[model samples]
Target: MLKVQEIREIIKLVDQSSINEFTYETNGTKVSMKKAAENVVVQSQPVVQVEKEVTAVQPTQATAQPVQQEVKETVEPTAKESTVNFDHEITSPMVGTFYAAPNPESDPYVSVGSKVNKDTVVCIVEAMKLFNEIEAEVSGKIVEILVENGELVEYGQPLFRVKTK
Candidate 1:
């Protein structure tokens, strides 16, 4: 099994290189990555083994289950949704884990109803073990938090909705 750090390293190398596709398989685990325009799609497959038993009275069958995993880098919001009231939304700049606070024990940078400026650090997005402080690019009041703390956020995913002053 590949560690999280190893997987991240692979992704980073693939993204920086000019290669369009890459694959690795070892010990029943397969990791495949493909570059699409500006985004890199990663997929993993894990092998499963099953055992069957047979007897004179009855027979049993064994089946192998398929494992599939997909990572989506971007999500586009639909125009039909009812988010027009907000003047601005604080969006994540990368695919990573969203952190509302600097650390586990600290208070969140901002919450619903909190006033913010153009440069206020609204949240942190941790990618590849790097903590990036995301700023509220517009002066406004936080009206909604679109994502929960510790949630996996995709690139350009909205983190907060703000009503500009």
Candidate 2:
């Protein structure tokens, strides 16, 4: 039987590393872990696996239960970079969908050469069914948008570049 502390340690190790899937098997214990989005799913069973084959095995003693947790992870996004020179970028605060307009037919919040101040809303980042308005933190003229509408964005991913005043 694996201790609770040991299981927690394993989860910690998996969360901090880049590996998305992990599995461990021993004499009487088998552990499999997979991360989906910001959540970690842990499955612990008393079974044996050998050489890419799975075999049913019984535990020698009592077994531990499965555990699941919501891990706050800032996953990396596949982004293309455009030329930027001395421009400040407006970044997303969470991993979600990015929308340039409030609705499908509405005009975008800002575009190239649009003058904006710190209080101006530049875009919206929707996460978990909630739409959050994103603001331009610096007074500037919009230079370029780095992401496409309806694209998935990661935390700290640059959305727009602004040539500050």
Candidate 3:
């Protein structure tokens, strides 16, 4: 059984951090705590210390690492929020050679500052023997086109940046 104060501290850690799991151990006691997934699970495990002739709480070699692990795990949120940007990521759906124009002499499909509709052809990506016309899925203004013409592109590579209106 855990004290009320311990439960409150765990709740606070979960709310404040992006950490998905935490574990603490000292001597004979080990506590494993994790956040709820899909807002439906709250589970806690507390290990009871067995008291015998020796009453001192002496940590064994196995339990020594948990304290450091907990601290590292808890600080993950602040680090992640500072680094990741989820906005306006345009990723390739297939592997191909990115072509700005349909043919060598033809004009390019669209460039920066181009206003695109859902059916607008953004660029041409050649896969195998077929020249596939890639369309704009979102109706937006093109902020930037990331890939160069005649460049080989892998799956999920960003080719353009369109600002959603």
Q: Each candidate: RMSD to true structure?
A: 13.9, 16.9, 18.6
> Candidate 3 on 127-152: residue-level lDDT in tens?
66578899888888877777778665
- Candidate 1: deviation at residue 38, Å? 30
- TM-score: the better of candidates 2 and 3: 2
Q: Please give the ranking of all candidate structures by TM-score, highest first, separated by commas.
A: 1, 2, 3
Top-scoring candidate (lDDT): 1
Local lDDT at 19 for model 1: 56
The residue pairs found clashing in candidate 3 are none
Q: Candidate 1: deviation at residue 61, Å?
A: 45
Q: Evaluate all candidate structures by whole-model CA lDDT and list the values in order.
A: 0.78, 0.76, 0.64
Candidate with better lDDT, 1 vs 3: 1
lDDT of 2 at 95: 65
Better of 2 and 3 by lDDT: 2
TM-score of 1: 0.52
lDDT of 3 at 28: 35
